[model samples]
Target: MRRNRLLSAVVAVCATSALGFTVPQTAAADPGSTACSQMPSDLRPTLILGDTGPAVRQAQCLSNMWGGEPPKLVLDGIYGTVMLKKIEWIQVCHGIPQSGVIEDHTWEVLYHPALDCYLPYPD
Candidate 1:
């Protein structure tokens, strides 16, 4: 009878332990994973005429990567009409919709010029 009681107690403890334990959940992708997508909305109106210093640098980098040409403009960090024109040119070169806005597709092309032929996944 003592052996049986001990076995029963062991089984009960195991069951209780199992019930208290929980599996941890896996983490999702980082928030910045799709940061490029937000670039359009972030720089909407400013993308038209000109941009600031950092914007100009980003544009120049993108232009150089896409065209394999040296950046002729100065990195004054101003997104002016000239910058807008250049952006349009890039859009034309990449065969993306010429909406005059630096949308997510435009950012992808700018960031990954070498992957011009690659298409982004559907939303």
Candidate 2:
């Protein structure tokens, strides 16, 4: 019984070592971190074409979440066409006008994110 117990312990250790990962000791949200909806206030330069920053990253993250076959944004903070198209899709889904601008309502959708709405727009 002692030999079997030692073998099991060795096997467990070997298996964990083979996995080659360090488990996190603890996890916590940053005290200064803002949620996605609150992300708009962090956006600056109005988040128009060619804009880039933390705010843009925030927008990209939300657009990715808002649901579409929309291309995934890299969160690199650049307001490129991919982000633009995804934002428009989200706006349309939420009944906002399909303007590619990440303005008030668009930002709202990004932050709150659950519009529970989408209309069939003719492509």
Candidate 3:
């Protein structure tokens, strides 16, 4: 009877331990995992180096969403050398031409960024 009681206690402890433990789940650490809707501009213009205004700010904000971290481009509504390089890297991530220009395809990427990029951020 004592052996049966000990076995029952052991089984109860095991079950309780199992119930207490929680399995770790895969984390969605990428910033672009969320939808891009709060943009400065709804106009999808063809932005290039030396561009400025609301559309440029929108592009800058969207570009910030890539690379799983803070955007290198300031939301100052101006597209300069930094924005150019970042845009090129973004283009590379999407397997597109690194044209440093925000056209239709680039706009698509800016709106819906990848969860992660195979390439590392450029210097």
lDDT of model 1, residue 75: 55
What is the Å distance of residue 34 in model 3 from its true position?
A: 12
Error of 1 at 70 (Å): 7.8
Name the better of 2 and 3 by lDDT. Answer: 3
- For model 2, what is the alpha-carbon lDDT of residue 82? 77
lDDT of 1 at 66: 39
lDDT of each: 0.52, 0.63, 0.73
| Candidate maximizing TM-score | 3
- What tens digits encode model 3's per-residue C-alpha lDDT throughout 42-74? 468898999888778777777776655435676
Candidate 1 wrongly placed segments (more than 4 Å)? 1-46, 68-71, 114-123
Candidate 1 displacement at residue 56 in angstroms = 3.5
Q: Backbone clashes per model, in order?
A: 11, 1, 1
**Per-residue lDDT of 1-123 in model 1, one digit per residue for the tens?**
999998997887788778995322111112233422323324522354544555555555444443233234555656666656666666776888766577677766666554232333112
C-alpha TM-score for every candidate: 0.45, 0.57, 0.65
Q: In model 2, where do residues sit more than 4 Å from their true spots?
A: 1-45, 115-123
